[model samples]
Target: DVKVTQSSRYLVKRTGEKVFLECVQDMDHENMFWYRQDPGLGLRLIYFSYDVKMKEKGDIPEGYSVSREKKERFSLILESASTNQTSMYLCASSSPTLLSNQPQHFGDGTRLSIL
Candidate 1:
């Protein structure tokens, strides 16, 4: 089974502090993604890495960035945490070839709260 590990199950931060969320996958999958889910907006993509040492900005990448220095790990950095940025952050991993359904398995999610 593919396993994805997230750095935190819950997080609290000030309105302008930086935050780092880490994710690791044991499957050595080539695709990793970061998404922030909100009550009404659903899931919004923040970033993704399709291969080692490669990263791409997703639809909502304004305050986020990603790093994939190794095949099995991906990290997300929030430049500054804001009240509006408080949401459920999910990390997912998928095979390099799986595109149908975008069938990526996810972590339990990190619930972040910015005060």
Candidate 2:
């Protein structure tokens, strides 16, 4: 089974504090992504890394960044956590399949609250 592990199931940070969310996948997948899910809004991508050190900013990468120095690990960093950023953060991974229909396997999720 493809497994993805996220560091925290729930997190609370003060505004302006730096926050780090760690994710690790054991499926040897080449693509990993970070997303934030909100009530009215669906899953919105933050960042994605195709290779160990190759990353692309997604639609809402303004306040976030990513790092992937190892094949099994990916990290999301919030320069300054804000209350607006409070939401469920999900880490997902998928193999480098040629098909675009490849679904991303997600971690349980980390619910973050910036006070």
lDDT of 1 by residue, 86-112 (tens): 899999999877465657999999999
lDDT for predicted candidate 1 compared with the true structure: 0.90
lDDT for each residue of candidate 2 in 10-105, tens digit (9 for 90 to 100): 999999999999999999999999999999999999999988998999989998989999999999999998888999999999998625678999
Residue 15, candidate 2: C-alpha displacement in angstroms: 0.7
RMSD of model 2 against the true structure: 1.1
Task: Give the local distance difference test score of model 2.
Answer: 0.94
Span of 10 residues, lowest total lDDT, candidate 1:
94-103
TM-score of 2: 0.96
Q: Candidate 1 regions off by >4 Å?
A: 98-102
How high is the CA lDDT of each candidate model? 0.90, 0.94
